[model samples]
Target: MSAAVRYDEVEAGQEIPAVDYNVRRLNLVMYAGASGDFNQIHWNERFAKMVGLPDVIAHGMFTMAQAGRFVTDWAGDPGAVVDFGVRFSSMVVVPDDDQGATVTVSGVVEEKLEDKKVVIGLTARSGDARVLSKARAVVQLT
Candidate 1:
């Protein structure tokens, strides 16, 4: 889908509506299968604890994908994203429960670059700790 946001319509510092993505144990299993990253830490609680993790942690790629989804959804086009990157700042602990965990993502238009491209600053948090940092996305608008 093409972005509804035109290059001239957006301004620096504009905020995109925040999104909360849910990550559950089942989702992790699905991701592991799809991505072929069958690391024990992501699915095995015993191995996770042995590795000094608090619990089964969500894969960094999973968290990054959620953040990327936030940006692409805002742009209204998955292909409109020209660049996207994030640093894993903290672990998202997922417990064996019905609710699992929630990752909240928010973004601000940091700058408007040349050629209808804009830089966006992103923040992703799970509980009280920031799970992703230095997250940024460059998107092209019509």
Candidate 2:
């Protein structure tokens, strides 16, 4: 954990440093094992293609978790996040390769609310496609 961000220090429209989260086939396998979500679409390219997906896609929840990590890491405390949500706009196709895919997460302070709370608008992208939409997080600052 790190020191909490003081509410007074953040201004609306301020941009947070973006992060690139890399996902590989092995990571998906580990996530599936831990999350108990053994869906073939996440690990089997053939099954994913059969289902009309371009290739094995990363779990939506896993992608969302990465976005959450982006915000929490910026806030310097997991507990700082009071609310968070996202709409899955597109699938994050993870090709079977050493590099797999990278989901870049970025955010900006949308607004400051009462009680030292701020609304952070988030964007998650893979290639040119927006993976997550209308993503937002309500974080409590010191």
Q: Which is the leading candidate under lDDT?
A: 2
Residue range 1-142, candidate 2, lDDT tens digits: 6677899999999999889999998989999999999999999989999999899999999999999999988999998999999999998889988899999999999999999999999999999999999999999999
- Give the per-residue lDDT of model 1 (tens digit) for 1-142: 5456788989999998898999999999999999999999999999999989999999999999999989888898888899999999999999889999999999999999999999999999999999999999999998
> Model 1 off-target regions past 4 Å?
1-3
> TM-score for all predictions?
0.95, 0.96
Candidate with top TM-score is: 2
RMSD of 2: 1.0
C-alpha lDDT of residue 41 in model 1:
93
Model 1 lowest lDDT segment of ten: 1-10
